[model samples]
Target chain A: MIEIPYNVKPRQETGLYNAKLGIWLFLASEVMLFGGLFSAYVLLRVGSPVWPPGGEAQLNIPLATINTFNLILSSWTIVKSWIALKENDFKGFKTYMGITLLCSLIFLVIKYFEYSAKLHHGIFPSTDNFYGIYFTLTGLHGLHVIGGLIVNFYLWGPGKKMWKSEPERFTNRVEVSGLYWHFVDLVWIFLFPTLYLL
Target chain B: MSSQNLEHHKSIYLKVLLALFVLTVLTVAVSFFDFGSITLAILIGLTIAFIKGFLVAGNFMHLLDEVKPIYWLLALTVVFFFVLFFMPMLWEMNLVTVE
Candidate 1:
């Protein structure tokens, strides 16, 4: 393996910048974290009774599918925001960011509707094997969405100068946050069919 | 910068975005087929999830820009996860009853 030096004089071109590399590494760890949950989900599902839980416990596939599209659209908007920031279009970045946040809010609204419906129907984490894993996994992912939204609030805050003067750093923030946001959305990509549709 | 520059790069990013969208639709469509088993559906879904993850990580997150050293680190993390998780999986698989 050829060793690439990290240190350089301020004026020199560094072969690879630190922020981009660092975010990738951070995302790798995030992958592993989600990987654990996914693997556990598979094991539980395979070992349990027929999926969607037969008789009165079946999932609402239509509701879940709608939410799935909601999240996937959010991921696209996040990428659009990142691209806008890269081009030094702060207004465009803000517009995309706003759309992303709105998509996220829409996701949560759909989720709350689904969750509340479940609760009203007497389904919950303590209900049974299937519901237990369902609530735990999706609930955990929801918490992350809330966390991502908080970060998005700051990244898109009013009068913030980061996106204009320091485009690289701004892009980094968007990219890293996008990485996390996409992972959250990606988890639902699987969760959609598994918990509800399948 | 230039609108021309934007036009030049637009198709590439749009193409990838389109791929992501198509793959998502494919995932939803595949879930409707029972495949005669839930495990098969999960396997298919997770496989797509990994592919989507790859695109998001490599392109959206810019992991592909990293030097080889970072790849090594990622390799190590993956190997560790497999070794750590699969052993328990193996044990669970051997048990006569999953419950």
Candidate 2:
């Protein structure tokens, strides 16, 4: 059975409260996951005659810039939600989380528009080396964003009872999710320049 | 730090986020002004991106408050990243046939 204690900070136990450590380890693996793809991309860029290929830059930098802003805003909303939870403001937590989730959806919508525009222009994975890596990397990142939405959904459940009573653990959960969300954004920080600007 | 101290910390986190946003825009603006070298532009942008990653990891991810062992874990993880990210590049560069 899980131990529940009141008026006390949980000690650094071996297994139960090890979620933070476990998540970090998982993110480390994720770094490797993206790292391999990025390495392949760099190798391909070195070999390709033209960087973007097919006589088209194909990346709408301005739209992507706006999406970048939306992602950053989402990160801020996540932090705000965690802060609210720490302050024991359940309503604030729910409100901020709702905004965060909305931003995530907005990001996906913008991504869909961007991808559809590319598709309409006939840019696709098999088009060339650039498009191949482009879709692979961004597509994987998009899946992560969707996964984050599912996590946020559970957190935002109306009947969720753990959040109010176990505020510390709840806040930790938010922080962990935020860590992952920030990582996705961090990857894009580098990707935007390499894929879009360069 | 008092009970209210965490609020101050949170504000600092907000400021870091704002700084990241500004730096990102700055990177985009700078991209338009061709620095005469594509490599230079990429270098500047990547440097800023690295800084942004640090802020995100150390502040938002709560790695700053983590103990020493966690830092070691992170460092070891990065060693693996360097290995995986660069080894292929090196191999590919060496294999490129000269005309």
Candidate 3:
């Protein structure tokens, strides 16, 4: 087999495995992707007569607050999952990853309720600027969460086979996924304040 | 990493998580009080958000120990990200001041 360079170890000069470098580069672009929307948000809010396009009361602050903590906990658990791999405890890794997956589901469930509540009252992206930006930001973030959940679920399920054969690479893969998961959490940290609290 | 090192790292993660929880609560609690100025309130909230971001990126994502190249990569991203954020405001000012 033709070997993929720097799969398990850092490249001599760059000091990161190929996957790590690639993921970070991807995340940098992701930053700009969201940054563009956030910039638009600033423009819209500044130009609008009223802030929050939807009234401030229209948002479910308590549910969003719960969702924020839910994401934070998932970030913690995913890191623990990676750590468990380091300890050579696959069971520990599975347990933590399961919890992390559960956290993702709980987050989306709360979001579903939030969205449904909004839609039930005829609020939507088309409703006005507030609902528009609210849907745009949270909708994109929700997609990222689902993406992470799929990858993590695979890692918890079928992807564990890699561990038996190539444990180091498996660990690196987990670390990379954990990094992406953390970035998702990081975005929400800012988003929660930007959209809900502030 | 040694078992000792892994154990030590685990402790750090726990501490960061605790800090995140407290700061999140702080984010909500501060919203309840009147801060007198909207910008000041925003500054306070975003400062807390940035701290939370630092904890996640620095500790959870291991950027504190990350390589120089990645830092440079992200630094460029930050520059452009801010440019993207501020470009509209700059444009708005230009339009307002042009007349």
Using DockQ as the measure, what is the rank order of every candidate, best first? 3, 2, 1
For model 3, how does the per-residue alpha-carbon lDDT over A40-159 read when each residue is reduced to its tens digit?
Answer: 988998897778644664888999999999999999999999998998999999999999999999998999999999899988789888778889999999999999999999999999
Report the Cα lDDT for residue B72, model 2: 74
Please state how well chain A of candidate 3 matches the true chain A, as a TM-score. 0.97
Winning model by TM-score = 3
lDDT of 1 by residue, A1-198 (tens): 974443111113423456545655776776677668767776776676765454445567776767777777777788788778767777888898898899888878888988899899888788777787888888888898898888987889953576457566667668768877887876777677566655
Please give, for residues B1-99, the per-residue lDDT of candidate 3 as tens digits.
457766777889999999999999999999887999888999999999999999999888877777899999999999999988898899888843555
Could you report the DockQ of all the candidates, in the order they appear? 0.36, 0.56, 0.84
Provide TM-scores for the models. 0.81, 0.90, 0.95
- As for DockQ, the candidate ahead, 1 or 2, is 2
Model 2: lDDT of residue A26: 85
Clashes of each: 0, 0, 2
> Which ten residues in a row are the worst by lDDT in model 1 chain A?
A6-15
Off by over 4 Å in 1: A1-22, A52-57, B1-10, B37-39, B93-99
lDDT of 2 by residue, B1-99 (tens): 135657666878779889989988987887788789978988888887788778777777666666665677779988998988788776666854457
Angstrom error of the Cα, residue A181, model 2: value is: 1.4
Of 1 and 2, the candidate ahead on lDDT is 2
- lDDT per residue for candidate 2 within A1-198, as digits (tens), equals 986542234244422246666677888899889989998988887777877767667788988898888888888888888888777888998998899899889989989999999899888899888889999999999999999988987888852477768667777777778878888878877788778886
Q: On a 0 to 100 scale, what is the lDDT of residue B65 in model 1? A: 55
